[model samples]
Target: MNFDYTLAFAKELDQADPLASLRKDFLFPKQNGEQFIYLCGNSLGLQPKAAREVLEQQMANWENLAVEGWFEGEDPWMFYHKELKSLMAPIVGASPLEVCPMNTLTVNLHLLMVSFYKPQPGRFKIIMEAGAFPSDQYAIESQVRFHGYDPKEAIIEVSPRAGEYTLHTEDIIAQIAEHGAEIALVLFGGVNYFTGQWFDMEAITKAGHAAGALVGFDLAHAAGNVPLKLHDWDIDFACWCSYKYQNAGPGGISGIFVHEKHFTDTSLNRFAGWWGYQEAQRFKMEKGFVPEAGADGWQVSCTQVMPMALYHASLKIFEKAGFMETLRIKSETLTAYLIFAVNQVNKELGFEQFKVITPTEAADRGAQVSIIAKDKGKEIFQQLVAHQVLGDWREPNVIRLSPVPLYNSFEDVFKTAELMLKISKEILI
Candidate 1:
């Protein structure tokens, strides 16, 4: 794909984009009356324009129907999640029955672990990537400790080879096989949050199953940003937050996926609650819990109507743009263009000022491009933000910029690079 470092070229690409009109659906942030070229969807998505109306409607339901809101209204609170299930399933490539909108990411992870992370006498170890999100590290450590095993001894972290920032699929597979006999579970992020490397989920799932372990993922950065096939890939279970690429607002509702195969596994454990009771007999208030027949059974509390309303507004945007397949096509090209633009910046500056750490291969990454700016990295990042080319800066010297296909344009990418090059020249000279 030939690319030119010109604003006209970027506008030409934008004009040719099929999903261009979809950008109008979101509300971008403004700083001092200047609309930002938001490129931080990997951290938090921009708000959907419809979010307020949807939230108001739910608030009205609570006001008008009061207690009756549970069973009344166009979308009954009791079954609101069903509508979300239908919309969410296509994004992750799973049956509606296999996915459920429920608690936030780590909470769902903990609940799913109770069912899937069974530590047998000999098989008591958990294998995960070395630098997973901090919450995951805490959860896995506590889970191992709860089972009376030393975390240092029971947790196996697959690390990148020396001097490398990402894991190779073969290395990950070999580690799983090496620890196959004693491994109880294999958990990894769908995309590493720091480097934005999309893991080979299908290969990892196959390896985990062959190694006699249950596999799962923390998809905080992957869901809606990348195409996934959780069901077809034979993933036992997975969980994700919606605030990132899904544009579900800050701390939006998270969801879980449980393969239909696990629905009938009576040995599985769950921290049962009233909402999880079989719907038909829920009014009877039976003393014993008969879990709902599908992923809904995993629900511990009743519907979070307000958060779900916001999430529903965003899912509608996804449905309007079709599914992940279409979005992924644009994502690949958009991210590639960012990489190319950054390279162009280096060429113009006569040095590798911005070193991209994220994989350039489309299949191995999603929307994020993490770069390390030499010498004045933090200053460059601050300048980007000040100039409204909004991206996030991490500790030391990393900047994570994600060009989300839903709202970002090629012009945004071009201007970002243009500004970066100018900033570099000013700072270095």
Candidate 2:
């Protein structure tokens, strides 16, 4: 579909957008008395207006009930995460029994690894993306070390072809086929954080399984940004943080998915805690760990009610907006418009110096458009921020702008591009 990004066209698009009113539900950050065109949802999402009330209610419960709040509050702290299962399940395409809200991303990754990363005598290797997020790299490295394996020998780090910014799907499948028998686990980010490329989860899972390895995903960037089918894809496990695209505030609760096939696998070992013990026997002060029946079995500690409240607030908005499908439609169009405008600017500048590192195909990417300005990249980024076009800067040279469909508009994309063109001519040139 051809998009004419004129101001009138933008206005007309907004006028017809069914999700336009959802923007008013968020609190946009302002600078110089004007709202910034927020394109940073890939880093941190704008806070929902409902989050204030949700957080306040938790504060009120704490003030009135104190320690008793665990069982006595309106939304009991003891079972706080339970309230989020239904809301989060659909977002990730999993059954409620397969999903659980819990610890931070890396922490949950480690916990899931404990159960999923059982390496046999000769076949104990882990496969992952080479430029994975630092936290994930550290976690995987530490897990290999903790298991008395040399990471250099036991971990396979897949990289893009020389001089490429993204990994090709064919390369990934070929790699799996070549080393499938020796691999124990295949762990990768569902959508790479830096490149904003969405991997083929189902395809990856199938390849891993065909090679006799368990598969998992670190969905920190993918969750709420791209549509997922964890259960249907037959993925073994997955984990994600809520602070980014989920808009659940900083360091909010993370989530996990454990396939039903592993639900009753007693041989699948885990680092158990009291919370993971069977609820009926939990209060009995049991001597042995009797795990919960499904994904909830992975819980190691009690839920943090405050952060759970914040997550609830955001999930409510997701539920109201019809979740992934609706947001995805807006996200694809908005990102396409931003890409179009940026390319136009580069053409007008008479130099194809700006390169979009993120994949052009909508199915291969999410909302983020990662651009590398060949020269004066940082200067261009600073100019964009100064012009109230908020984006994030990665090391060396990438400028990542994410047009979150829930809060960002087509006009915001237009104005952001207009500002970029102005900045490039005046300062970057």
Candidate 3:
């Protein structure tokens, strides 16, 4: 896996990519009729070319069938999410029955917390990585408060060692061990949004259980970006959004996973709705809540037909691309090449202009490489944007560039680095 920071080398890789054809499936943003090199899939994915048509078909069903669309349309709005759950399960590694497409990411997190984040007596603390996506932090803080505990005292944050950018697995394991007796739940992002660190889920889950705690993850970045084994890892629960790597439309439908072990646990609590009522007797208007057999039981309200339609369209493309394992192969090499090319720019400048804080090891990261651009991070980012090289910038310094395997080419990676090198020479501090 040698890398050369050359346009010809990148084009050669593009020519050999088995997933190269997928680039045609998405419609990229344009600048003066030319396509932009979109590396912002970590923030928002490019739209699929057929997205409009997919929406229209669902729209047509509603137009033609009216209320009957619930049970009469080709996909039957009643159960449209079923096929999507099946397609998504293997991407994150779970049983189809354990996965369900429903509600927004944070909402699902709350719903799941209601059932899994039980705290009592002295064993009431929650352990999580520091600087998690803010929504997760809020969820944990709010949940801890709802149970009448002080957030500062009940929430234990496992921070990186001083001056380090990422958490080591050993440090994470040690923290769990040190607080095992008091931790009620161990929750984390499957991949940290800012640093792009993919945590060791299996070890975390085992450590949590050994300490008599439940475990779960918010897979907002990791779900479609890497190959996961949520069920195999014995994680108690998990959730993810479809917009990023799943390429569902903006604020796309979210999904959740509840392990089979929790399905019949009568003591667990849930915020239930009629949609969660067992399908066979749902319309009977029964009083007592009887949940559908699996993760679908967590649904809080009637499905939003359109977002699920948008997500289903993207899921179909995932099927054509031969799933996440195939995508992971390209993801690893694509990101490694991004790292090499970015470093090569620094090499030519005779200084390290940008420092990649994301883990360089393939297993520790997914598609993203987070970089801190010395003092010009934001300036470098704006220049990259002006040149139609679209990536993401954080508040002060970091830029996140993700070469999505489904659409981004090796040429995209090279040209971005070439532009970065060019911008460095042209821009004055």
Which residue runs does candidate 3 get wrong by more than 4 Å? none
Cα RMSD (Å) between model 3 and the true structure? 0.9
TM-score of 1: 0.99
Instruction: Give TM-scores for every candidate, taking all chains together and pairing residue i with residue i.
Output: 0.99, 0.98, 0.99
Which candidate number maximizes lDDT?
A: 1
lDDT of 1 by residue, 18-130 (tens): 99999999998999999999999999999999999999999999999999999998999999999999999999999999999998999999999999999999999999999
Per-residue lDDT over 98-154 for candidate 3, one digit per residue giving the tens place of the 0 to 100 score: 999999999999999999999989899999999999999999999999999999999
State the displacement of the C-alpha of residue 12, model 3, in Å, after optimal TM-score superposition: 1.1
Q: Rank all candidate structures by their lDDT, best first, as comma-separated numbers.
A: 1, 3, 2
Global CA lDDT of candidate 3, please?
0.92
Residues forming the 10-long window of minimal summed lDDT in candidate 2:
1-10
In Å, residue 212's CA in model 2 sits off its true spot by 0.4
In order, candidate lDDTs are 0.94, 0.91, 0.92
lDDT of 1 at 314: 94
Q: Which stretches of candidate 2 lie over 4 Å from their true place?
A: none
* lDDT value, residue 175 of candidate 3: 90
